[model samples]
Target: MTDTVTLSLADLTARVETIFRRAGMNAAQTRALTSVIVAGERDACKSHGIYRIEGALRTVKAGKVNPLAEPVLDAGEGTAIVRVDAKGGFANPAFELGLPVLAARARELGLAALVINDCTHFSALWPEVEAVTAQGLSAMVMCPSYATVAPTGGNKPLLGTNPFAFGWPRADAPPYVFDFATSVAARGEIELHRRAGKPLPEGWAIDADGNPTTDPEAALEGAMLPFGGHKGAAIGTMIELLAAIMIGDLTSPEVLDYLGTTTLAPFHGELILAFDPARFAAGRPGNPLARAEVLFEAIVGQGARLPSQRRFAARKISESQGVTLTAAEIAGLDRLTAQGLDAVA
Candidate 1:
């Protein structure tokens, strides 16, 4: 059995922030990243939680990610498009810098798009979407990963396990948010399965020889299958253009060539679009959120749970109790802190 240690949310964030600070991230960047990391754990998204710390450190050491990044924003006049250059940093600071602009632009223009480039994105997309929704705007974000998923009917891996997230504000509760990978399962899930020495679910991936396999190790060496067959592949390909090609950043395949191994982070691109429903439905009854609540209640009454409902519930529990971290995770924090801030500087 695996050993675990319980840590309060404050402790977890403080630990994570300390490591990032030691790694040369400024307070703003450290706080932004710490928020994301803590939220992942609070929401029980283990795949995107403390487990990612080691990889983050490695990327910083490898010179693939800049810890002292300052994202620069360029806004177009008379247009709803804003571009953010992450300057080879991680996505957290860029999102922190650009999300406010996205909301403001959406409010001013009724719709806005924020294209983020030259960053390594290593967390779940739900946090970004939910943040926008909290600002009373609808939001969507799409990002491509290092290629680990194959197109339908293609044995070779040509697409990343592209993820897409959407959020809608609610009148009475947290926003209804949903985030998913086009692949049958996220590559991180496969890594977790590998760590646990467990078999993947059927249809998740294939062997190196292109035969379907449940072995996580084999699947890692092979390719992940897209969800819903060709349908998922189509969406994944669309995300490639929206998140990578259109942003003039390296595509998934191009990223794969650069990383040379799936273990490293690929500084890629992300596309986020936000819309102010108030601009469109000014005359609607009770506003967009009230209307959405009616639908949300109806769905729940029909025995269907809204997306992220469980995560929201889990957050409350985590706040009351604590997040459980593995020994290795704690050790990792210790090791990084032991290295001292001067080492990274």
Candidate 2:
């Protein structure tokens, strides 16, 4: 069995931030990226935790991603929509720069959308949605990337994993958060399994010959099946259009084409929407959060655990007990600290 070690949340954040800075990221960029990494770990999301550090360093060293990118926002045509240019950097800073603007616009006009272009998204989508929800607005965020998932009737990959996240405000509890990928499994999960020499579940993927396989390596080499067959495929298609065509950004196929000749971060596009419930529920008896609390209570009374409830619970435990990390991850961090990007540091 693989050995595991634990670290406090504060130590984890400092270590990650130091590594990012050593990789040449500016303070703001480092903080943004580190926050996501720590949040992933806190939520017990192994796919998005420190395992991503090696890939991140590789992308920066190869000049595939700009470590010190400065994102900018442009409100297009009206205040209801805004576009953020991530400048070939990771998605965190771009989302950070655009969220407040989008939240403000939603508060004013009742609804607003933010289109993020040319960014590398390598984490869970829930954080962005949660940020918007914390502002007392409902939110939705989706993004398309390099093709990795096959459509319902075919075996070849034709779409990105295509994550979608939604959040609703609640009065006496944390926001209701739901985030999922259209594929049977996220690409990061497959990568993690492959690294650990583990087998995937049935129906998670098909081999190169379009045959099902439990081998994580084969699954990665071939195509991931959609989560719910045609239904997931349809949602993936809609996300592709909204995140790419609607934003006048490159589609999944286009992103794959760019990746064909370079070891670069696939600059993907993200689409986000924030809604002010007050606009719709104004003068209707109770506010959105109060009504949502009642609904949540009824749902919980029925013994239903809402989406992201497990994650929130995990975060509390992680804070108290510290996060567990594999021996390999600790070694990798040490190598980065000692070597300092001498290769893919």
Clashing pairs in 1: none
Off by over 4 Å in 2: 1-6, 188-200, 209-218, 261-265, 320-328, 343-345
Q: What would the C-alpha RMSD of candidate 1 be, to one decimal place? A: 2.8
Model 2, 1-345: lDDT tens digits are: 659989999999999998989878987678888998899988998767886777777778877678989998896646688889988888889999998889889988899998888887767889899899989899999988778888887888888888888999876677899999889887777888999988998999988778898999888788899889899999999989998888888777778887662234567788899999998787888777777888888999999989999888999899999998889778888888776567473
| Cα lDDT listed for each candidate | 0.86, 0.84
In candidate 1, what are the lDDT values of residues 1-345, reduced to their tens digit? 668889999998988888888777777668887898899989998877876777777778877888888889887657888888988888878887888888899999999998888998878899899889889899999998988898988888989988989998876688889999899997878998999999999999988889999999999889999999999999999999889998898889999888887787777999999999999787766767777778887999999998888899999899999988788777767877778443332
TM-score for each predicted model, relative to the true structure = 0.92, 0.90
Q: Looking at candidate 1, what is the lDDT of residue 343?
A: 36
lDDT of 2: 0.84
